[model samples]
Target: MPLINSDTNNVNNRGAFILFEGCDKAGKSTQAKKLFEYLKNNGHSVELWKFPDRKTTIGQIINEYLANDKDLDDKAIHLLFSVNRWECRKDMKNLLLSGTTLIVDRYAYSGVSYSVAKGLDLDWCCSSDRGLLSPDIIFFMDLTAEAAEKRGGFGEERYEKKSLQEKRIVESSLKLIENCNQLPLKEDLWKTT
Candidate 1:
């Protein structure tokens, strides 16, 4: 994840929605924690939310799938992930509206890209998350697939494979917000890590 910030004119008087988006082991969690602590230490209101929030009912189902305890159709698991985000949409909006900065690790981008890489339709993958709160900024963490494989416990997750992770870059997922003009999406889509 890039560890960056984003803002949109539609959301006023709200805390920034800082998002860290990337493949597994790209240091998204590491960076999100640093930003959260930095904001808290500075006396700023902040909250950290991770997707597949395994504590939720839907999340638990998704968790089982990711853990390989259960199997789901590609489309089924994709929607489950999207629903997990939807389940928290209200809370996320409330926090943002209350001026609480939300540091999110992984989100719709991950949902779409991972599924698409696994052979799901991009439009279908994006449709379910159409109205979700947009991140003020998306930090696209960049790390080579080789580098990620070298990270500890790399193969633990179901989608942590190098071949898939390489195709799982943020640029492909940026299409999720292509219609949103306020976001400063990079024109250069060919990012070589």
Candidate 2:
């Protein structure tokens, strides 16, 4: 059963906020969209969201960087990613409070993992996202870099390359999620289907 908050009066009581995180081609967006549709079809209020939204001003910048059209320092791009999330933070909170479930594709976890894999300080990466609303349920779609590389869109984006960095990012992501006390048990962390 989905976890529910006891405060009936709180907006969070209406629906759970779920996030999907994983490497490129691991189906985070695909699964998030499917879940969003499933919930909506069941008469639940649900919204699908993606990081580096690519629609907003900041997101556009991220899009350019990811497309290899622009070059940014590792830390610069990292902070920009966090800032992009901050731009949506208030709206996200409002949606949850309004009894809507947000099926989000990626979040702070991605920011931290990718940056940490690039040799950035883990504490700094995490601290940059402080105060962002935590997900009620987070699903990490575990896929080996080799497996992901075989996918159709692999290597299409800057971060989609199958390199040692990708492997390191996966390792960092798993460790970070494992250390998160608010997350589910380790056995429940990987969603493979």
Candidate 3:
């Protein structure tokens, strides 16, 4: 028998990992879905995943807390959301290896941003997403809180309150991109004053 080449055996023609990031009501989801459909129609096998999937077991806990006013501690809910993504990580890798393009609505960045925005440890947030496949292209849909709130029902979720979101969006944008780049200097990803 011929010697097996480990590189060839492991190498797969994965398409790409595309990610969209933004604050709440920034139209990131709408744009992500549109991009996914467009890619699908172009004969590309594609998959869509949203962070805190909120359907898985861990996500269910997060969903209950966010939606039902359940008494889960802040850190607990934050970690549950992080675990939710970790649980699906295998499938995420498998799909990418199977030549399917992944159009993720939100990914580790949002997890870090939103979690750290709540005064949790930024380093902890960054560490939670360690080892996740880096995105081929990351698109950040920029929007202002004033404009976003005008879209209606912005205060529906636990983190969607106007004051908190505005503060987090501003604070987290710079920190999030800094973490994304792992750079010493913080860069603002979203264009807001």
Model 1 has an lDDT value of 0.79
The per-prediction tally of clashing pairs is: 7, 0, 0
In candidate 1, stretches whose alpha carbon ends up further than 4 angstroms from where it belongs are 1-12, 174-193
The candidate 3 region of ten consecutive residues with least summed lDDT is 183-192
Model 3 CA lDDT for position 4: 24
Listing every candidate in turn, what is its Cα RMSD in Å to the true structure after a full C-alpha superposition? 7.3, 5.8, 7.7
Model 2 alpha-carbon drift over 4 Å, by segment: 1-12, 181-193
Of 2 and 3, which scores higher on TM-score?
2
**Which lDDT tens digits does candidate 3 get at residues 119-161?**
8887766666666666767888778878888887787888777
**Model 3 misplaced stretches (Cα beyond 4 Å):** 1-12, 183-193
Rank list by TM-score: 2, 3, 1
Overlapping backbone residue pairs in candidate 1 total: 7
Candidate closer to the true structure by lDDT (higher is better), 1 or 3: 1
TM-score of 3: 0.84
